[model samples]
Target: MTAISVQNMNVWFGTGALRADAVLDVSFDVNEGEIFGLVGESGSGKSTILRAMVGLVPTWSGTMQIAGETLGKKRSQAFFGNVQMVFQDPYASLHPRHTVDRVLSEVMRLHGIADVDERIVQLLDDVGLGAGFRFRYPHQLSGGQRQRVAIARALAPKPTILLLDEPTSALDVSVQAEILNLLADLQQSQGLTYIMVSHDLGVVGHLCKRIAVMKDGEFVEVLSVEAMRRLEASHAYTKHLLASSIQSVS
Candidate 1:
């Protein structure tokens, strides 16, 4: 079954002569429990698609079906409960004044979930947090720990689909693998589907079987992780990106 379906989606800003297109005529489908990757540099319209899907960008045009519902200008309450997003910067995503417990509790409250206390404990554990960190502020935790809390908060609503926008990009290289491992484990355990946008093919390949290469607000190509590893690309831009990724590490 398909978890997400997008057809000829276009997102733009401004109007008339001043208009700028962020994403143009993009379409893709993600199967249940699959991790789909979108890779490109800044202003490549990679993140615009995710924002459109979650209804963050109101000036979008096209069909978006997620979690079995056709999207409209506004997202329903059930849609939010079924899908959640984890942003790139953990510290910026979370409130400094809110404790871990308070943050998780508030989400659960808004979702009308029962047994908030027990669920909070379980979510913390699921994100690899200890009981001692429950009442701590975002400033009190390390980068990785703060990201774990962000993951925990996204999971607080018990979503089946996750929108990850460069989830580990802000973290140290040491903890990136740890967070990636945690995400992979969580997906397998919870049977969750993910749409991940990242510039790092290595990170994307770790969690995604297939990826779409976006450039100038359009998809240049979609390729498998195996082909990417073999450095086989159909487009010149993709070849350049693959080469860039390789040279950065070597």
Candidate 2:
């Protein structure tokens, strides 16, 4: 089953002479309960594709489907319930003034979910944070803890599909592994599907079974993890990326 399907999607910014395409004729399908990765350098239109899917970038053309339902330029409340996004920066994504309890509770309130208190505790526990962290502010928590809170908040709405944009780039290497492991566990336990965007090939390689390499607003190649490990990329750009990733690790 296809969890996400995008077809001929084009996203443009500015107007008239100032206009430029951010994503061009991009299309892909992510299977249910699978982790699909989009990898590229800065300004490669990877994040733009995610933003467009959630209707953050409004000037887009073509069709997008979530769980076989066509997505519109403006997503409905029901759409948000099924799909949620976790940003690169946890500190910026979360509300500084709201305590962890309030943060999780607010999402449940919006979705009309009952048993808010129990759900909040469960969400915190699910993300590896105990109930003691509930009443604390963002400033009181470390980067990894804050990110765990962010993950808990994203899960609060019981979303089936998660869009992760550089989810661990801001964390330390050890913390990144923890978060990635947590994500993998969550996906397995909840049967969730993920579309993760990152520039770090190592991180993508760890989490994704298949990856799409993007460059200059288009997909250069879509390859399986096995092919990537074998250095069997067909595109020059993909080979370059793989070389860079190898160099970075070595």
Candidate 3:
């Protein structure tokens, strides 16, 4: 099953003289139960593509399909239910005033899902968060803990496709490893289709089966993990990015 198909996708912000293109003719496919990695440097339009997929950037012109339903045209509740996103900043994603329970329960209520206490608890557990922390506020949790809450919130909706925007970029190296492991475990158990955007090639290599490298709002290279490990010749931009990312990781 194909989870997402983006064709001739073009994104530009503003209008007339103020217009600036964020993504230009970008295209990709994410298969069901597979992790498709999107990698690029800063200002590479990675997040812009995600924003377009979720209908946040509706001004863009392209063809995007999520689970056989065309985006932008389909406003069905089922469409929203099948897709969910975990943003880059856990601190910003969650409301400081809302408890973990409230955050998860609100989504449940919106989806007309009743008796979510048990389900929420299970989701929290699945994300490695204990029941004792269920009622705690965001400020009470550590960076990793808060990210876990964000992941739990995303999973609480029971989405088939998860769009992750550098999910572990803010954490320490050790914490990043833990979160990466947790994400891998969750993907395996749930059979999820993941579209992860990150600048970290190591993270992409570890978690994703295939990776698409973006440059100037377009994908310049798509390579398998093995091909990347071999360090074969690719586009100049991809080569530069790989070298820089490797240096950063070292």
The alpha-carbon RMSD values of the candidates against the true structure, listed in the order shown, are: 0.8, 0.8, 1.1
Query: Using alpha carbons, what is the TM-score of model 3?
Result: 0.97
Question: Residue pairs in steric clash, candidate 1?
Answer: none
Model 1 agreement with the true structure over 1-250: per-residue lDDT tens digits:
9999999999999999999999999999999999999999999999989888888889999899999999997789999999999999997999989999999999999999999999988998998987889999999999999999999999999999999999999998899999999999999999999999999988998899999999999999999999999999989999999998899989
Off by over 4 Å in 3: none
Give TM-scores for every candidate, taking all chains together and pairing residue i with residue i.
0.98, 0.98, 0.97
Mind giving the per-residue lDDT tens digits that candidate 3 earns over 94-118? 9999999999999988877777989
lDDT of each: 0.94, 0.94, 0.89
Per-residue alpha-carbon lDDT of model 2 for 1-250, expressed as tens digits?
A: 9989999999999999999999999999999999999999999999999999888899999999986679875677878888899999987998999999999999999998999999988898899999999999999999999999999998998999999999999999999999999999999999999999999999999999999999999999999999999999999999999999999899
Model 2 local distance difference test score: 0.94
Q: What is candidate 1's CA lDDT for residue 37?
A: 97
The local distance difference test score of model 3 is 0.89
Worst 10 residues of 1 by lDDT: 48-57
